[model samples]
Target: MSGDPVAGVTAKTFGQLPDGREVELYLLVNANGLEMTVMSYGGTIVSLKVPDAQGNAEDVVLGFDSLEDYLSPAYRSANPYFGAIIGRYGNRIAGGQFEIDGTAYQVPTNDGENSLHGGDRGFDQRLWQVSAVDAKDGVGVVLSLVSEDGDQGYPGQLETQVRYTLTNDNALDIRYQATTNETTPINLTQHSYFNLEGEGGVEGQSGILDHILTLNAEAFTPVDEGLIPTGEIRSVEGTAFDFREPTPVGSRIDGDDQQLQRGKGYDHNFVLADNASDAKNGSDAEGLVLAARVEAPQSGRIMEVYTTEPGVQFYSGNFLDGSLVGKAGQPYEHRSGLALETQHFPDSPNQPDFPSTLLSAGETYKSHTRYEFSTR
Candidate 1:
């Protein structure tokens, strides 16, 4: 626990689970007055406030105000993932099955016929043990979890730690660390739906269609009808998937392309060009590269994503309907927010050509992603 009196972190009781487990909410404030609220349940980021061009701070992430809403049947039925931490495997695995060293393993299939985001009960639903940490550059919270062998049908006793640091430079840095007693496949990522225009959006207009996005990638992995990667890394040239330059998110979203039709919008994994080679070459220092950049003209808020991962999952909230009410009682309409999840390629376990996600016994897995906020 952080005992520093001047530590920019505070905690309060968010709510209680059905099993009487208490969930704690930690507020991390940086020197620049940026605030981030995170709860112990699901290691979720409930709210993140950043200043716009006019120096007005507003919540930019979509989430519920209380833990009850997150536990509600309506919310569970939708399972939009919100701002939780996805783990074990961040994306879909074909048929909910994979092999490890000639041994076949079967996991729960929660998303149609494929296993999505670590089966039915993923790390997003786990109550993590959290503690405040006073870092040299900022204040933060560390959430830890222990997944016993066979949990979620994985073959390992995995111990994981995620640290959320709010730095003075107006950056939210997420660091993930994990270790396993047995060889297992692991992919972890933070799923935060960000609407730089602020939750519902500026004025009465909703949706992130106007947000300009740029991805530092030239290709993306196409998906099948079930949204699972087809093990092909195709070029994004002359396609709607091209975001090499700053382009409005909705400019070509509805274009007459098969990939666009399959995803309903933009829901695909982009192969990060900058980090791919460095990752393969084991160049740790040069591994962190700019993955994506987003700007909201309405609020003049810009966010840049840098990561050590080899890929980023760009989701335009294609499935968000007005069914779930979020912070300030606002309906989460379609395309209201977007997520740039820094992670390994989806279905890597089944894609023989993709980078391996296997973490051997006594080996450590570490990944870092930083979201730096600023105004133009």
Candidate 2:
């Protein structure tokens, strides 16, 4: 049973993997009636229920109802990293290859010629261990996992932990921390497709294409045909990529811009103007810079993204295709939802000009991101 809404953590066995390993689900609810359910498998947020303008709560994140669906071959085969924690690298690495300390390494080439979201089997597929739980400021669960040396062709053993905290202020705070035994590349992020219209999953139930979105970026990293950064940071002045002001996502999504055509939609990363270097330099608490703000007029739900990362990837869910069914047997259609992934610029390993994602021995990698929900 849920305790006082102020802060609490509840756990139960969710399901089992093919190998018979057991997985657990933790429910964290805050004072404002915001509830988040996370699972040990992939450290995923299976559901996030937030109150809307009328004070009615609904799940906003796209996911399934049963753990079996998540473990099924069909679900696994078609997963778009829905509600999972992405790791090792959150975005693409050109040609599935990179050089670290003069050593070349090959990663999983799951995305055309590039490696995406940590390769063929990433942290999203791993079973993380719950290390601690606290319900002070809010209900917080700390999930830890250690990626073995050379796992998916990366270097060193990376010991990482992600803390999911549901705050009384209706903020879902995700804090990432990691350390490696040797020099390696590390980028972690949450991959949640949110449809502020509420996770109805049925056709016409939600369409993020019309959601008003505002990104705090003056520039963006353009991509090539394969969606890999072309090593150039260009201004978004007159381009459709300009999201400096609040604009409907679909306003120019179908424009004749070459970049829009290349991505098939908005899948590019916007370079954040606010500097978060102070946080990376080991500050205990760093101010989370506003990255993006999205609002769904139909439901009157608003979500503001804050992070300490250098960039945010605004994905318009261009590939959902309606083949996969979600919670309560709801069919997920094209552009039904969207993902705002906060992280370092894509292909940072290959782009020396971008902020480095490399982590050295004895150096810790820390990142903070938050999604604050509300109603207008």
Best candidate (score: lDDT): 1
Q: State the local distance difference test value for candidate 1.
A: 0.90
- Evaluated against the true structure, the overall lDDT of model 2 is 0.87
RMSD of each: 2.9, 2.2
- Cα miss at 104, model 2 (Å)? 0.9
What CA RMSD would candidate 2 show? 2.2
Q: Put down candidate 1 lDDT per residue, 206-294, tens digits, no spaces.
A: 58999999999999999999998888999999999999999999999999999999999999999999876545211234356899999
What residue pairs clash in candidate 2, if any at all?
none
Give per-residue lDDT, candidate 1, residue 183. 87
Measured against the true structure, the TM-scores of the candidates, in listed sequence, are: 0.96, 0.95
Cα error of candidate 1 at position 226, Å: 0.6
